[model samples]
Target: MKRPSRRRLIAATGAAAASFSLAGCSSDSGNGDGTPTGTSEPTTDGTATQEPTTDDGTDTGGSGEPVGADQLARWVPVSDAFEFDVRAASYYDADLTALAEHESDFYTGTYGRVAQSLLGAELVDIVPPESREHVVQIVPAFTIVLRTSMSAGELATAVTDAGLSETGTQGDATIFEGAVNSTQSTVAVVEGVVVQSFGSNAQNAVETVLAARSGETARLLSNNGEVRTTVDAIGESELLVVAERPEDASSNDPSLDGAIALGYGWQFDADTSNITIGVTYTEGETAEPSALASYLTEQDAFSDYGNVGSSVEGRTVFVTGDIATNQFDLLSAGTPGESSSATDAPQVQIAFEFEDGTMTVSHDGGDSITASNLSLVVGDSPAGSQFADQYEEVTAGDSVSVDVSNVESGTNVLVLWSDGRNSQMLAQAQVP
Candidate 1:
């Protein structure tokens, strides 16, 4: 990873002036009513009022209001199981539509086509595009909500038209189950909202989200003080991602060692896209702004693409980066370890699963590689050397299996990428 040039760092410092500024940081005080203290009241219209805009229309800092809480408040409370809470408000800002379109593959790949079916053209027509907001909470099992203008009958007609059938009902919510792109999913549709859950216990997940949305259960923004403070610090943006850091987050990188939560906010511009990466440190832990700035600048995606800047507010450290519109493609090239400069040894992430007597290796993401270029190298020679030659191309989600029952459980398995002349380890795992 290359360091940002001195000129670029200066440019980044100037850009950071216009990017998200820290309103305040690390306030755990909350009203007993579940609402975190320091948040503004919601507007009469259901949605929370946004921060005041500048003369040219960009959001100016210092309102101290948690701008996007209305959407986050519609989801279940952040718990041990909650991994990512994402809000995409393309309707509010047309700029986000382009950004979302560019990252469509990521959404569909991560959440699967179930997300596409719910957020596809059909529902977009029923929902008021300008005011519609999509919130996706991933606990590994997804709980998605689309704030819409469609009534119950209209939503039913749209979902039915999309080949979904009513599976059951929970209170005022109607649950529908169906397959999109051969993937099974279930969604709960209630007045002015469409909820979906993908993975096991879909119905139960939908119910949980509905309970949170109706204020029957705890809401994330109101109950989770850590997340509330982090989000407020990041302020408003077109896309916001709030992820709860793991308790045992021991990272080789010093900047991430004691991270408690991560808040990422992106605001698009006519010529560039500005991103703010905020990391909440554990209590009593402090962040080194210079180290954070250097660490973030080296991130593969942003390495040579833009200027990087950093600032510390209380226990939260915010690193802001700007990427030019022309260089935007680098952001989708996959993260550091998942990608490389080699053309023959394409970037790929493989997951190895040992079951019964077989070891299945699946391509989770990154570039697609020719079958002949990949080899399962266990010890010196893999159990099934012919596994790679069986398929013409191995793509994301594609899996190849080899008989590993004879191999010891403690042996190591490696997925090697090669074009005969050159070879590199794409992924490796210990036999378990």
Candidate 2:
């Protein structure tokens, strides 16, 4: 397999998170320049003021609890040294483990694949369950910080076992440089955290994280007050993502142009799911929150989950809503790329039969769909008018007959499945 570039790395990870519609999501390594002394051409202009001191075991190591999402800002390179277009973070709350069991194929199969790709099979396996993860990007260079339970010694052994050679040690972190599963990687193994960087700019990316943690470089949180305020408001979540609207953003969406920064958080409470999305607008450019909230309610793809509401305070517009836990598939199925085995649209094989002036629609195969979600139309009549009663679930071999005695031959017949927000044609044919 060919080596995947840093840009593609972000794409794969973003797809896994199903982030396309969450907040205006974009991924690009900034103007590629400023290559520090390294193995390959660097694609980012991020610089670090200090290199980690040679290993001294005396310093307390990663033995403490994994870094929390609240402190992630400290690990981000200062804005002066790094010019990045986007940055986001993810945290897998312990409760997500239970939710994953309910949707194993999507949670484990789809999301786990992305994690394994970035962290290597060995390290991914050793990572503690429900470990939180963070990613900071500097255009073509990106750094991944993972909170793992493995000790520094245990992590070092895993890194070397995964085909990396010990290059040096930075304080309590052990640095390894090599190819893991065909991708050039620079990985650091400390007590409870493992910072990994990939692609051509791996070395500098890893070094940047170490520098930020050591306070050699100013952290993004300390330098950017707006981001800090937004982050503080959002706090911790199962999935927390934040991005600053770059001065040179190329997007043409009028609603997004005024955005100064966006903060999104997703959480689940047993049978209910809640999402909070906030957008900080520039001075005097804030859009009407009520109108935006109305638009979201009418266009919510997961409307079956619950209602969407909004509130505006100062420059920020907050959109909040809850979804039924059973409707979680709507989120997972939206994930793009081959890594996702499930689809947002229902996959059903339907067959239509005309006999004795009556039409029969049969579900031949494919995934089961809710009966209320299916709408049948005959000769332009209103949807579901012909059905006397609807089944709770429609699966293979299920069939419904509609009286078409008054309909003319060749009239159009259609079956559509909708989840309030979106719809798809399951089968269409002309009545005989």
Best by TM-score: 1
lDDT of each: 0.48, 0.48
Runs off by more than 4 Å, candidate 1: 1-73, 80-132, 137-139, 304-307, 325-330, 333-432
Cα misplacement distance, residue 245 of candidate 2 (Å) = 1.2
lDDT of 1 by residue, 1-432 (tens): 122221112112221111110100001110011000011111122353333334422221222332222453335432321222122110111122334444433322322122232233234444544435444433223344665556778877777787779987876788888754333457788765677554334555576566655544445554444566667777766555544443432354676667666556666555666777777787777579878777766654456446778899988889888765434332333432343323334655666677898888888887888887666655323347444666788888888788887776534454555453233445545455
Q: List TM-scores for all candidates, in order.
A: 0.57, 0.55
Which whole-number lDDT from 0 to 100 does residue 14 have in model 2? 28
Worst 10 residues of 1 by lDDT: 22-31
Provide the lDDT at 114 for model 2.
33
